[model samples]
Target: MSASISVIIPIYNGEQDLPGLIETLRSQTYPASCVEYLLVDNNSRDRTAEMLIAASEEMATQGITLRPLTEANIQSSYAARNTGIRAANSEILVFTDADCRPQPDWLTLLIEPFAKENIGLVAGEVVALPSQNLLEKYADCKDVLSQKHTINHPFCAYGQTANLAVRRQAFEQVGLFRPYLTTGGDADMCWRILQGTDWEIEFVPRAIVRHRHRATLEELRSQWKRYGCSNRYLHELHGVDLQRELKGKESLRRLARWVLKELPINTLKVATGKGSAVELLQTPLDLFSFNARTIGQREAKLPEKAKEIDRL
Candidate 1:
């Protein structure tokens, strides 16, 4: 039988988590013959290609086809995803990250909402995986990646690509994800789909995936910096002001106060067992994220600013 759904995952040095993800896919409740797995290797420098080759052989033995493709020219996950979308044969295109482990019913629930003719996109729920450290614990408590909060929000309302599904026709109409963006491309695509077409994006709480959060301070900082750069690019693309949104004297002052006074007091309370450690740790992380993003936004716009100066 032909596949009714195609699940696309983009990988770059994802060897650590690939095994579990493959196992999850193997055990999915959806019919194995009716699902096509497209794993795109975005020029991984590790054993990702080797692992996928082995996985393809194993999956084939179970009556499943795992197609491994390469997107070596570009280094962006969005570019890799676009490559997968173009190669997909199914009517429904589902997206998830390499580190995410979908529940057995994830595919079933993700595709169920498409039965409604007006629903063009489905944003599934993403819950943080079990935390192994303070940073991961803090991330879980903050639930920053949850799409439930994005529903009905005016300025931002979109599902993350880590657990999102889109109809093939609607996806093509929006022109797929922008290849240039290193981040925020998922939100950009959802926004274009909503604004450029008559279709609606629905949040399916039942379709769930367990995601692994940044396990260390360094990883967290790097993630936020990338997010910052991406936010700047997104603002430029949509004609919004990044400086006005992210950088201001008042914002800096508030961040300072939070870091110096409030964070210490909260940490003290947590140490004394009078407050939640997760909540307290989240404060500093938030400030760090803001500052990192501001720096990234400014850095990314340097070339553009130089051009403006030359023009003047």
Candidate 2:
């Protein structure tokens, strides 16, 4: 099989995660000769560039083309991904994050749907990596990074770029990701493809990427804040009205219920050793997520017309 697929991963200060990511790529069941790995460095300040160079040299003899590209002018991951998209030499492009570890068959299954010409996008499952940390456990319990929620979204089904694949032809037709978009670019891309062409999206649960959950409260807050920013972008760019957001008194009441009711019950359960720490942490995590997202949404501001569309 001629190089039919290119895996694009954007990294910034990813030295700690790159080795494991490279190992997982090396272990991919997909034939190395038929795929290229485009690792785009989004202006990392650490040893990420040197590490990528070392990885490229080491993996070269393995028939794996590990190409390292730099997106210095643009600091966004989306910008880095756009760079990879332009440099890719394949008809199909697969995307994942540096912090994720794909199962051995992840690549094989991820690109399998592209056999059908009409399949424009494929999203695999994202499962949290096992961790003893409280926040990580809470995230795992809540399925925070799972693609199921996005794939089943009411407004529009989409995929997270953490484990998504797209047909190059369809991708080009829809145009590249908003180069400067810091969040929600994946959803925007998928929506564009769906609206612009006759292409379809697929969800393959077997093609799993193990994502590291945020181990700290600060990390969790940051993640949700980005998600909130994404919500705003989607609304401004695509007119996706997120009705799920509770506002004003409703939001306060929801938080109060968690604190006044569920917290005590879960605390007692934990005290009795009948409930997992995961359950106890859920309430606080929810509160943190809500506040962070609210802040992000309030902070996110976009141009009046971020993307062009005819309202016909």
Candidate 3:
């Protein structure tokens, strides 16, 4: 039977997670036959591709299609994912990162919302995978507690990409995610869909996955920097007021709150060179300056393009 839905796993050196991920999907309540599990490997250096091949062979015995696609330097997961969608032979497209392992009911829970013809996409819950790592704890707290729900409206007032699934039809309408988006591709894609058309994104809490944030302090800081950089690009492309995403007054308030609640954490992070505790003081000043500069860049970009058009 042809696939009704395809699950796209965009991988990058994610060999570590393959065994658990493949096993979890196999364990899903959804028939292994109904969903084509597309393991799109973006040039993994480790055993990811090989592992997928082995898993495919094993799954083939059970009549499951564990399809694998290979490509290089699709440096962005956003690009890898769109490639997988194009390669998918299904009406619906579901996405989860290589690092997240879903519960057995994940696919069934996420796809059930599609019964409403009006629903464009569905987002599942991302729980924190049980880990001894502090980063995992932090990720779990932020992702699970801070999550929001949207049934048929803009869903990403607070967004993280670890647990998002979208319709293939929505891709044709909204266009694929930004290729240059390094980290906030999930937010960029959601915002793009919202800007172009009205599509309902159902947030199902029961359809959950565990996010495995296997990062040290250094990794966490690097990831945050990448996020900030990507946010700037996403907001610029979509013409969202950067000041709002940054939330100038709110950021200051948050900084104050952070100073109170996170000073000790900052001390550890700063001592380890993970972040700048001193820079934390400059946050309010930095927020204003950063907003000013981003606006300047936005304004400057317009004239440069206008000049090109004038010469043409």
Candidate 2 local lDDT, residue 272 = 93
TM-score of each: 0.87, 0.93, 0.73
Q: Specify the highest-lDDT model's number.
A: 2
Evaluated at residue 96, the lDDT of candidate 1 is 97
Pairs clashing in candidate 3?
152-200
lDDT of model number 3: 0.67
Error of 2 at 142 (Å): 1.0
State, as a TM-score between 0 and 1, how close model 1 is to the true structure. Answer: 0.87
- C-alpha lDDT values of all predictions: 0.82, 0.87, 0.67
Steric overlap count per candidate: 0, 0, 1
1-312: candidate 3 lDDT, tens digit per residue: 433888888898877888888888888888777889888888788998888899999999988899988757556677677778878888888888887888988888878888888877777777776776545555554452234632322434423556667777778886776554555567767766755678766678888888756356555544554545554554555554443345567777877876776666777788889976344344443454355444443443222221110000
TM-score of model 2 (CA atoms): 0.93
